[model samples]
Target: MKKIKCLGLVWLLASGLTGFAKDYPVSSAKELSALSLKPGDRVLMKAGEWKDQQLKFKGNGVKGRPIVLMAANAGKTVLNGNSTLDIDGSWLVVDGLSFANGRLDSGEVVNFSEKSFSCRLTNTSVIDYNSSDDKVDYTWVSLRGTHNRVDHCLLKGKNHQGVTMVVWLSEKPNYHQIDHNYFGPRPELGRNGGETIRIGTSTWSFHDSFTLVEENIFEHCDGEIEAVSVKSGRNIVRNNLFYECKATLTLRHGNHSEVIGNYFIGNGKPGTGGVRIIGEDHNVRDNYFQDLTGTGNSAAISVMAGLPNPILVSHWQVKNARITDNLILNCKEPFAIAAGYRKDRYLPALNTYFAKNIILSNVSPLKVYDEKVVVNFEDNLIFSTAFSGEKGRGFELRNEQLKKGSSGLFLRPGQADFKPFWESEQIGPGWFLDINKKFTIN
Candidate 1:
């Protein structure tokens, strides 16, 4: 008997059998119900490779301590070759495993099954979980339940037609929290619809998600123009670090969302961008945009227009947006109005506020596609060798130039630990002087 010591259980290493917790074929809904797990209960799956294992992990747990299903060893309980997990329960947690070798047609590597509530998927990983065959589409992780969270996990190598992670909305709002995770490289799909994260689909853009995507790192995610495509209302994207991603965080649909306290560091890379705005009643504030080189639609910040009397699926007109207290540095286009999408009888952006921002050393600070788009631009500082005292291109050109003082402002910006080094004097305007640890892959 080969001894295998594990969390909350012991197992035979040779036979891949466990001592504690139920061991049943994860193939039946009736079998899972038979477990009848409760609060503080634990289940340990058999340690081995599971190919195409489709099962429902069901149980209920109370607050403070949720039920858990853990691997015999971290990263040892491998699920491969189109493997999928459907978690169905309240206050359950899945921890310490890896799901890999997923096929293209594999719908979702892991899904918080419908009706699940207060669940979490933490400290796990999903790598290379994508559709291998062409013309097939699938999401890597689908979050369908409510009040769930995905944290301290690693999701990488998503090269397929669909999004890497998604929050599917329903009759009730999905108040999900996606935090402290690492999103790895996703190569350019050369077409549309390869977003890193999509909050909700356009089919139900009117739904209120109330989701939060914060403290995550998006590394080299060159999938499409939109990195985190928001299609629902009242969502929040904050405290995230987007490093050299050749895309923008687009508010693609709905309204009343906020993107704040995020760091977008392009390091002078081509195609790298900051944020794109759509719809109305949104707030994009207290963010840092540095070294972005995208010119037109991929500008550091692009506000989009919409068609007249648009439907929920269509892009809505930008209205009553508050874009303030941001720091934009060394970008090609810091501000763009009606960016890159113009056709038919379009409605222009209106009643926007751009205030108290500090912009520096951009090739072109403002890009205006629709001159009819009006904004209340006030109290903004521009410190550049280029244009000065110009009210034409979205800037008012206030008095005195701001300088990047004698600090390691550009020190090793291409490295993984790269961040703009700001002196104590230049520490205001929502920019931080320290290394943003959320910028790394770890």
Candidate 2:
């Protein structure tokens, strides 16, 4: 009897798996629409062209078992000619698809609806997907849900008015993670408003999205001033490479965020900027900025002054910033304290700390216009630059020289080797354990 009960339990488990886990091979939009999708459903697209098909995927799967929608083959299935998908539910995964040679006629290419949660789009590519109208604005992917992820996707040739992707934060924190994606070749829009990724808009900029953008390559993003204009608070931009882009990663609107471990290789380009810092309590550390030629407002690191406490909606005052452990090399105007400041009675940057930073290359490192501004500069090493004779009210200036004719990459004394190179300080973030890497691209 016990042996029969064991065999009966095995049959029941097999019956349960067959009852719930189903693979639906869809060809037409009507066929996909006709199905009543439940949890643990796998909707697989056949290997063919899906043109002009605006399909909407809707299902609410639980946490451990997500509803999946993938192509039959990884890069074989193509979505062309104004083809798009609207994800409307939670815990859904769309993967292994490609959108090529398409022009969206009206709306977004992929839109996560406002009610969705924990959905993901992974291992996909969208190439040359634009709008039919140049004047009309449309986002490639507009993420409106919380805890959604877009990872390992290749997005290229966005030559339109709006952003490539956006994490729109409304009532709660989105907590989205955009990792290991390739943002390639966004040519210069003749006008403005061509950001690659915008976290939030102006009215919702004060909210905390807490988004994490990591290990992505932003190449030739020549749209406007901000390649990734971070407008929301508590967002993290880390371990990304900005290669020869005409814009910088700007913390334009939010506060209490951090930009760390990013590599900015300008390759002697004229307008390639590194990091533009605005707002308050931002931690800019452990990054490498080199070979840039951007000046003035487009410097390697620009610290904007604040508007006087006025009666309007304006930019925030730069306060309580901790800028440390950076290696700035061979860039024109690497550090600017009161960047883009005029003489017309503005609020100064206050309570900012600049320490443990090493600046090499020519002179003219710091650019401070306001004399009454509050900044603390200490323990920073300089090769051929000068910014501080006095840092604070009674503080002493401590800009240590690298001893002219010193050699190697700051490893040996007066033994210079090749061009600028840095062995950065190793820091283990609490997110990762026991992994020792200097600016490790996460």
Candidate 3:
């Protein structure tokens, strides 16, 4: 009877029928790599500063029973100085780890390998991780494969030449969700490759990413004019906040994408851009832009002219663009139509619709660089004290009174329950709430 009972317990463990999974406490990367974790198991790293640890956590876990690797203490376990992580399996979670004071000359700081799927990286912080040589390119986080999530983390102060985070694409669409993270200040890199987040690339621009980038806060991210560069088709960017970030959320090489319900607060800063539109079948709607001071390609909305017979990496012509229902206030040159209309690049936006937009600015609202573009403008209202004589084809000058709402944002009549953006306490790791007090509105 005793032998039979022991064999039954072994069978239950082997078959994963038991709810009790083992939790191993590891002190080093060597111990972590040696352990074979099963579904529902956990490997907790001991609390302290771990230096130069290259941790490769690979395992397979089933649905509803993901293998977890986390810090023993949420914010106390720090990985510094040349540390990196690679997650290379399905249904794995990496949580509550901090990477600080690290410099990787090349290679990513955290990589979800090509085989990884249904994995999550949450409540983590990568702070000031840079390469000593600013020209050396390396991504901070690289997400490969499908069905991955990166949420509630802080990616701050990436001053290198490469992107801060990237979503790699393949033949099939990668359905990744990137939400609720705090992307802190990144200074200007002066050249290309300073984007905070890039989804796909020019080589993979024709593929569908199907990625969702929502509810993130981008504060002071002045990295080469693109805060988030969307380079694939069929993606959505919604409800995010861009605060004083001398950059635009550019749809650089995508088609059929949507940018909706976002806030761009420029605070009258220099080189503060809003959105640059390209490609076909795109929608830009329901966004609020305030106090922006950029013009031309950095206007609140720039419908760019593309190159004649454009290549894969060149700017494509904007076609079938729907720009509607946006609130533009106190921005300089709010609409830049036919932007970048050079001699060689004169392919104008075709069959575009601009409607139902409310603009209240003291400056001139429209700057149509090209006269041959076919854009239908209707149901748009404009009220500018400096441009009361400004008359255009598609908009009427109406005196609409604006009032401050409960969220400290000025709004028009019949518009209620609107928020300016997320508070700093609402994003990032749970332990890093004090960052809210560090920022001041200009």
CA lDDT, every model vs. true structure: 0.77, 0.77, 0.89
Alpha carbon deviation, residue 403, candidate 2 (Å): 16
Candidate 3 global CA lDDT score:
0.89
Give one digit per residue, the lDDT tens place, for model 3 in 1-442: 9999999999977766588778999988899999998989999999999999999899988788899999988977899989899999999999999999899988899999998999999999999998788999999999998999999899999998999999999988999999989999999999999999999999999999999999888999998988999999999999998989999999999799999998898988999989999999999999988889889899999999999888889999999999999999889979999998999989989999999999998877888899898789888888777664346777788876888776667676686755444752367788776644433444
Q: Residues 1-442, candidate 2, lDDT per residue (tens digit)?
A: 9999999889756444334578999986667778777778899898888888877889887777788888877766789987888898989998888888899655688899999899998878888888766667888888998999988787889888888898898978999999877788898887868899999876787799999998777788988878998888999999887878889898888888999988787878779898877788999998878777887667888777777763223666788888888877778888877777876536788888988777775757777767677778787766663545544433333345543222122322344553322232222111222222222221
Would you list the clashing residue pairs of candidate 2?
406-414, 406-415, 407-414, 407-415, 407-416, 408-415, 408-416
By lDDT, the best candidate is 3
lDDT of 1 by residue, 106-158 (tens): 57778998789999988788888766564478888899989999987778788
- The C-alpha TM-scores of every prediction are 0.83, 0.84, 0.94
Models, CA RMSD each: 9.2, 6.8, 2.8
Error of 1 at 150 (Å): 0.4
Pairs in steric clash, model 1: 104-131, 104-132
Off by over 4 Å in 1: 1-34, 389-442
The TM-score, computed over Cα atoms with residue i paired to residue i, of candidate 1 is 0.83
